[model samples]
Target chain A: MKTTPEQSEQRDGTATGPGAGLGTRERIVRATARLMQRQGYEGTGIKQISREAEATLGSVYHFFPGGKQELATEAIRHGDREFAEMLRRALESRPDPAEAVLAVAKDVAAELRASDWLDGCPVTATSLGTAAHAPDIRLAASEAFERWRGLVRDKLLACGFGAQDALELAHTVINTLEGAEFTAQVARDEEPLLIAGRHLARLIDSYR
Target chain B: MKTTPEQSEQRDGTATGPGAGLGTRERIVRATARLMQRQGYEGTGIKQISREAEATLGSVYHFFPGGKQELATEAIRHGDREFAEMLRRALESRPDPAEAVLAVAKDVAAELRASDWLDGCPVTATSLGTAAHAPDIRLAASEAFERWRGLVRDKLLACGFGAQDALELAHTVINTLEGAEFTAQVARDEEPLLIAGRHLARLIDSYR
Candidate 1:
């Protein structure tokens, strides 16, 4: 059987095909996420994404028929999953739930410090930019948030909080994490993240 | 005595003079703030602000010699003060500190609902947009946040929390409010705001 151009490209990771391999798609998504993280959804362009991804315009449209909005939706969902997994791993590394929450906070602070406070939660940036301009993107971002919240809620429930209490606590945890991220990013200091994390730990302790 | 052009414009609720009248400046700032509340600092343009305020581009430059950045600075500061004042009034209106906090939360929720969740904290959009691109804008945003945190801290202290406790609590409250606003705006729902407020009340109750 002879492989078609699209099939060959899909298999070789050099062309646009259903089997175009994961690397190409990953690269495109990563590039789009990075640009969106810096300039926001409205400010970023598909051309820039193509250039950043080292792929051509045809390749982008081939992979994402819905164009920038669809590409952004995919990138946001990818980032949310990757970030939540990383955070969950960080939390699980600690023995105590309180300590795990604090550890995750520190990890967030460390990441910000390493990036010179230039990076923030991609979901947050996307949510703000598209909440009004693009409803589908907003919904996609909201799904990511609910997923992250579920992760946190499960952790709190494991720590003995009731289901209702755990849900509320999870909301606070995420809210504080996000809020502290913005504060730390703007101030170029880890104090906000550290302080917010400590306060979150105390909140968990009260439940215990 | 004949009224100067500035004086006449000031009296007539217009700004058509050399120095520019209070009405014109106020209108410009208010319009800019409103635009920023919906979009963001980078997302908005001077032309848009001029049109919204019913003024000319020349008038914007005349009022803000430093251009868009300068206009944004003034608008963000004005927003900061207005938000602080609203918080203060809300907090002061209620006898109990916890009740005061809840009241402000309700007020914030109502405002968002009234606007169909289109409006959000003015500085949030700007802060996220400028966090990576413009350092000066980021600094300005940070200062505004510090001022807001200070106000919230004072209210918490007045309600009987210790200085350290109050500061920590204030940080959480602000973070929750900010996060909730982001979620509400993205979800196009007011429930997140109310949920954040209720969670905040619980945290405060535990301390009290």
Candidate 2:
């Protein structure tokens, strides 16, 4: 079933279920993620999130209770899970590990292009912004990265790479995709993504 | 001649110079670069830059009249040059490209650990933050990435790889370093860096 905005908001705690209720909580988190993706955590504001979500300040406080940091934590968690699932599906699409890895890179490239290069790994900007300011958020972001890395490592190991080699390859592949995304986003082009994908394929081929 | 902090500030714009005062304009650029490496552009404020450099906000404005955007542009330029020079020097320190690449990775690991895992590629975090918020900064970051890629490609090409292969390898190496840093920073461990360095060395060897 297609989830309406209202449904999503209600499910995620943004709005009161039923009439005259604004889903303040869910809307705030979604808006926070969107703003952070575009302008970064420090650059985004609670007021903007409230306005974007079409909710009042009182509603935001009612849901989050902890303000911006709480809202950001929830948003980052949501983004992390969404991205991890996306990556896993991308990786599992192909039986061959090398093919799967390249496919994931291509998928990310397409996603970025579709967003007009405005969107990228959601945690990237937040990870940087919160690194020095909020260690708790940083730890949450770190856990998200590890989960993704674990997925890649498992896939490569299943493809016959030794444990050590598999782990290293996974690390390299994940980072390459990330670094390439950052570069491609900045360049507003897909060349870096494509180039990084090809290199990752080569590395996998060498292992085989 | 040893320059006092006051003399250095007068000459370079920063209270302490990384080396000689390249000049007031260059000093502001270099200080911004160093600060970005540690704290990212978003987290590092213009006021902090001015205070750290012992320059008036007006002096900073006078040098980078466009404000933060202009300062970032100059910093990206300086970072690109510095990274290229450093990479070239590391590569030249050994005749074998594979060995040189490994040496450079090891050196990066050492530096990262020494900084208590607090440092990373300024371009990585800065690019992530600016790509969505500022198009001009995005372009500048892209240019810097391209320079680094070109340098790596040149080294790989000299090692007997085809043009396409060289470019791919370059992207992979750069990505590995960057991705590892991201993970390491979050995990607060040096293992990612060390492992990535060894893995890159092995990847290079496989080509031979």
Candidate 3:
């Protein structure tokens, strides 16, 4: 099991240590993702990203010449890849799609709790209300979601499920997990996500 | 069958005409909710609120001395009540709880599409990424989620689901719908929500 830099940063839960060793561009993108996870796109600023990454403001602009919007798209892509990696690992951990889906929910709940509810799905937080105004941010978020859904769909198809069932249930899995994560974060409790995991597992098993 | 000011405003999908006739305080709250639904809390500003509400800055401050946070709390409450009304109607529309749950998702998807995806759930838009920082906004959002969960739990209980089953399914219902609504908004398509509706209905039917 090889751990990517993004995975290590997520496990470390902060942009220090190995995160600091990453290049300035990677550091800035990671910082932006972390900030947007906590404060959202509009709430996060370049100065804060520079401060968080321990990089100069000039470096942030040097990497992201288009400024915040461009940087946010990259940050979202970073978040997207991180989540996809986690999802892939979870799905591979079990031969049964039901078990894999349950694993994802459990893993997500644990990670969110470990982050003290601060590390939400960056894509959802950044793009929640920006769809009408920020096309790039919204597009990045949408792509992230689509990618996750695609992964789930592929796994379900690899199982015995039909194509239509796999597609629709993939949407259900992603939507339920997304919603459950938000509820769990707000309540600062893991019950919602845990319950979602159990029921979603049952739903997936019924298809078999 | 009677429409309250909030219901009318939601139906109108704008803060004009009937929205204007509402008193300034109500107007301000409605405006805040609408803006936050599209732009989120941090992205929405006081001046923008005043402009949308057609109220003076003095009047806005006079009504909510705690400023944007206070006003946002009220706006969340406004959104909460409006959603409660919709949920109540949806739950009451059919004799079977499963049918009712499906109806709720359908109605929400239709409403989001009608708003051109600008009108998202106010509590979610305002509270995402802020739970760790904004206690007041976080509390309001938490209350709204709890209230919605209670509505679903009560409906499930009335349908003869065991106490434990009702409670857990209630969480699933809200989490899935919330997630589905978000995905639908980002995709500018209703398939996610519609799939969620079908799957949830099937999930509920499994209990029977």
Please report how far candidate 3 places residue B158 from its true position, in Å: 1.1
Best by DockQ: 3
Tens-digit lDDT string for candidate 1 (A27-125): 788888877876777778899888777678988898799998898898899779888998789767776777888998899999889988877888877
lDDT of 3 by residue, A6-104 (tens): 444433434464465466679889889989889998899899999888778987898799999898899999999999999999998899988898899
- Model 1 has an lDDT value of 0.78
Question: Per-prediction DockQ, in order?
Answer: 0.57, 0.56, 0.75
Best by TM-score: 3
Estimated TM-score per prediction?
A: 0.88, 0.87, 0.92
Model 1 TM-score, 2 decimals = 0.88
Q: Which stretches of candidate 1 lie over 4 Å from their true place?
A: A1-22, B1-22
For candidate 3, the clash count comes to 0
Alpha-carbon DockQ of candidate 3: 0.75
* Model 1 CA lDDT for position B131: 67
Where is model 1 chain A poorest over a 10-residue stretch in terms of lDDT? A1-10
